[model samples]
Target: MISMDEFIEFVRGGPLGPIKKWGTKWSLWPVHLVTACCGAELAHAFACGYDGERIGALNYGIARQTNLIIVEGAITRKMAKVLRITWEQMPDPKFVIVMGACGLQGGIFWNGYHMVKPSDVVPVDFFIPGCPPTPEALLRGIRQLQFKIETGEAKTSATFPEVPLEAGRKPRVLPKSPKKISKAPAVIVNAPKEVDWEFGQKLVEEIKAKVEAKSVTITGKNRIAVKVESDYIPRAAMRLREMGFDHVKNVNVIDVPNEDKFIVEYHFSSYSVKELMPVIVNVFADIPRENPRVKSLASMFPSADYMEREMHDFFGVIFEGNPWMGRKFLLAPDAPEFPLRKDFKLEEEVYVR
Candidate 1:
């Protein structure tokens, strides 16, 4: 294995160093991680005579010999893990080119729960900003990467200057907006005020009747924060389902380091309960963060499949009963540790062996 000092010397002085100048001038190999909608322009970059290969830049399969990772677009929390792991797996002297606005910040998914900034995981070499760049724009990015390599510039610090995206352009080929469907006639003019279900009352009764936890606190309208013993979440979820809640809308866990407890919260709502339409019930439990563990709700809410995976990704809070809870999800596999907690600041740099 190459020692750190020898690796640095090889990067600066070997045959690898001399070839970089000429290779960058003619051989730009872009490894496509066609993550989202921006793949169209990426395809155009290599298509007939817009032919990226003519300039000696070719698209290659991800192999250790390959050193470029071009992030196409929106990487869901699940894919974020993949990006990180892939970065770690590539050989050293690797470079990253972040393509499109979505890859930078989450783009239209800015407020989406299942997202992490690409730069947060790996040191980005360049960011090509557009919803989907044109073939010419993609070629320009390759040229820029080659220029940087030729100049012996640091691959991790090259920044792509900002360009505004065109307004009102559809990112996907599908219709810009869904066609309006006819409204139901039953709730038209003079509709009676909707009956509200006392979800809180029903929830409390169900918990009291079924769960033997320490204390269940009710907080916020349509929200109940339960402080159950860690072992009973599965039972609580089953009881909540029996009480008519059908889906889990969000699964969030807050780490309270001061109290040495992780506040595990699962927000649940119902499809079968008409009167409970707007009500949302939040079931919470506290567990020690060091050994933070909770029952998986995938059985009760199939929609929570990815949510649990994401929570497991950032908090290091294991869902003991979850089917999929291994490796990276929102953060890269190369990331040092759980990053969402208050303690894990992005500015800190610590070398990992």
Candidate 2:
């Protein structure tokens, strides 16, 4: 749309030209869009040993000042929105570097319903693949980005091509689920493992006697899984509390869509009891997916309060006694409903006044 002189000036980066390229390449400040375990690896790159200041890519908190975005680790549905918003805020001549196996293909969260690829969210210049990529490797990615900035060598698969859209199709259509969805492997957390922990036997026996659970098995060295009925979660929590398992370390909800159930688990561990401090007891229960309701253990284990609200928001799992139920907690008010569920489909919600 511009004249020949204008086009030449644009290609030459206005007046500064090579000086601009040189400045941009060296002074590539990064704004982090990090999540999960890969955040630690990103921190190590900026830590005492590696020295990120020397690399000339010091992390900035705000988006406008930074030219680079280091998207570290798994990008969820919610995080994808944040990534786009942050990327849009940057001034000009921006670059994206996704650093982790999770950012590319989900890694440990391999078939997760909520997982969103970093490349799908933004134009990624480099992808450093590892469970968590090393500091040296991340440094190399930054250097490559710098190289691309200065030299304009657009490597194959490094950046996205601006594809012309088809006439009838809308961008960012959600993928259709397979006609027949298979049930996930039932034995994830409670898979019985025979470890040489003699103490586990007595501990399991004690827990079994106290809590009327369907199955009580040692999953790992110091890990015991106690699965009770949905109605019996409160009773089981109280019984575990009486037996020195004082607090809830973690509360999780696993969606088993094909089975028409949701597995709710509370990882109970002891702080006051020194002997039991090393051990972790995972008490879990299954709930009907259609009518997901269970007794909340927030009163019994205060730590379960926030997680219960989070689960409610993500999967629409109602914890009957939790006061914070029937409201948004972790997710935005406009976010897709029960997004973590396996059969989640994107649908437009309309309101009539």
Candidate 3:
């Protein structure tokens, strides 16, 4: 029903002129699809300090209701599928804000196999570059997006000389021994000193005695690994806290499809003990994949609460005692199975894109 001249003029007038002149400008709902550590800064940006809501940008968790998406950081191959799907689910004339240095080009994880560029996944409106950019910087990025949409000008285009992909470069051969290895001038050398922790060994001994596990091996100087029954994790975790191991570092659940067992580890460490310093003690167990249910030690270590939730989100391993384990998938709702597990093939997964 629309004519060509009007269509041409509308295109020239840009997105904000007719459809989003005032109401949408004052209601830029941002969909939060947090992937990495930069999510912390993003939370601050939306929170009281930065108050992104001042400009009418509300951080919404739903995809259908949001016009803008701020991808936090590091979209893994699995998360890339999620990013693409979420982008597609969003309404027409949607905008993407790729936040953090990791979102730009993988940052510290550049060489990582799992990572993918956010720009490649979606048509990015703005990029806020920092490991995890400050809340003010994130707000500035949102403002930039608003400006670009209003003006119909790409704010981030760059002109650079292109290098040939097949440019000839010689590969360096490695030396056989330390004496033969050439020392680079940029490298710094600090003299190694003896580390004598006052109560490290004593704490380890006390903690080891409390666990009824087969073996409590001190792997690194400050790291301990305990092989325990799946049923005894709660008791073991309680005892570790009594021995000054207060905080849980992480709860890692590695799925071994071939072995039909899930390797669940509770990596705990102490913050209060002076001599024990910052030691991580891992209490691990091999749980059956057929019935992947484990005793949740979240009561003993509150930090393990979200970690267990994330583990359940990725591995489908049920923590029997977790209060909120019934919620739909956190990362991948439509994923066929646990993508992080060995058997969930990328080629086999039916992505919305």
Q: What is the C-alpha lDDT of each candidate?
A: 0.75, 0.86, 0.77
Model 2 C-alpha lDDT per residue in residues 1-353, reported as the tens digit of each score? 89998986876677668988988888988998878787898899999999887967899999989889999888887788899999999978899999888988888776665678888888989989888889988888888887788889955334677998799985575555445546566646688999999989999999888889999999999999988898998999899888888999999999987678899999999999998999999999989989999999898778999999999988999998899988888775656678777777643233342
**List of clashing residue pairs for candidate 3:** none
lDDT of 3 by residue, 1-353 (tens): 78998886676466735565455556789998888898999899888887889987999889988889999988876788888899999986689988888999787877454668889878987888888898988888877777776666657533489987665867556544333323323311112223464455676577667789867665656666788889998999888888778888899987666667888999887789875456877888889999899988787678988889888877889998888686644554544445577556443212241
Ranking by TM-score: 2, 3, 1
Cand. 3 TM to true fold: 0.50
Off by over 4 Å in 2: 1-64, 67-77, 80-201, 214-221, 256-259, 332-334, 345-353
Model 1 lDDT per residue over 42-120, tens place: 8888899598888778889865657888899987766877888888888867889888989987788774555678898
On TM-score, the leading prediction is 2
Judged by lDDT, which candidate is best? 2
Runs in model 3 deviating more than 4 A are 1-199, 348-353
